[model samples]
Target: MDSSDLAYDVFSRQCSSRSTLEHVTGRWGALTLGALHDGTFRFNELRRRVDGVSEKMLSQTLHALERDGLVLRDAQPTNPPRVDYQLTALGREIAERLLALIHFVEGRQGEVLKAQERYDAARGGL
Candidate 1:
């Protein structure tokens, strides 16, 4: 397909970009991408780094990212097979942007918590 024929509107239900956006922005996707940004990692290492992610979810996330061409999975034919995941060039680009957002959120976490407290108090919620 021609580049100009591509759908740029993510708001449209039929837009393919929506699926890509979903994969990139999903909870597992975000965390997985963020962790991979540091360097390539084995499955268990990724699990530890992501924290609270289940093996099934991690596997699913990795597969999806790989399918999206954001992650490259390399399997070595060692006696005890070893598989490592690293971000592709495209993955690195998107991961950098996502990491920036993550850093911003981390930096503003205190303010965000305070805002949430105020919002909850207004709604009579703890």
Candidate 2:
């Protein structure tokens, strides 16, 4: 099918975009993309910036993003071999949107916590 003729409906279970959406919105995926938004980062740097991601999870997330064409992995031929990750054009577009969402949630965290407290109290939780 032609590119324009392809239909992507994320809500549909059979839609390929659903998988891409999951990767883009997954915990590690979002965090990874957000970190790479500033510039390129080596694996260790990404781990430090992402705070809680395990090495395995980080590696998997990077691989997934690279497969999705949202991340570029550049490996330099050296004695020890160095690799860096950066967001592709498509990745930057999605990362910017994700960052906005993260900012919004962060800004309203206090309010969300208060609402959660109220909800829990109503449900008989401490």
Candidate 3:
């Protein structure tokens, strides 16, 4: 049919789901999505908000997100080469879902901690 219809079909496929899930749920992906949930940020700003991520890791993660049509990269010609990043419409939707996922994980942290403690004791790692 048309581009819009083609896009819908692709999005409806199982493969698309798997691909998007992999990008959005990876260790760095989750953090990056969460960081962008607030608003647009420069490259260095994103790195700072993402906690322990390194420059290389951040670069790789951003590239993956950009390739998947989740994040937008804006490079401006400036004295120091300013680069800014923000979520696309698709990215914003994904970020919202990621925010809920973050809430879910945080809510379960206590239970998870207890389970980890029990497992550690059983395994003699405690």
Q: Give the per-residue lDDT of model 2 (tens digit) for 1-126.
A: 796699789999999899899999999999999999999999999999999999999999999999999999999999799999999999999999999999999999999999999999999996
Which stretches of model 3 miss by more than 4 angstroms? 1-17
- lDDT of all predictions: 0.96, 0.96, 0.89
Model 1 spans with C-alpha error above 4 angstroms:
3-5
Highest TM-score model number? 2
Query: By TM-score, is 1 or 3 better?
Result: 1
Enumerate clash totals for all models, in the order shown.
Answer: 0, 0, 0
Which candidate, 1 or 2, would have the higher TM-score against the true structure? 2
In candidate 1, what are the lDDT values of residues 70-118, reduced to their tens digit?
9999999998999999999999999999999999999999999999999
Instruction: Rate residue 59 of model 3 by lDDT.
Output: 97
Scored by lDDT, model 1 comes in at 0.96
Off by over 4 Å in 2: none
Q: Clashing residue pairs in candidate 2, if any?
A: none
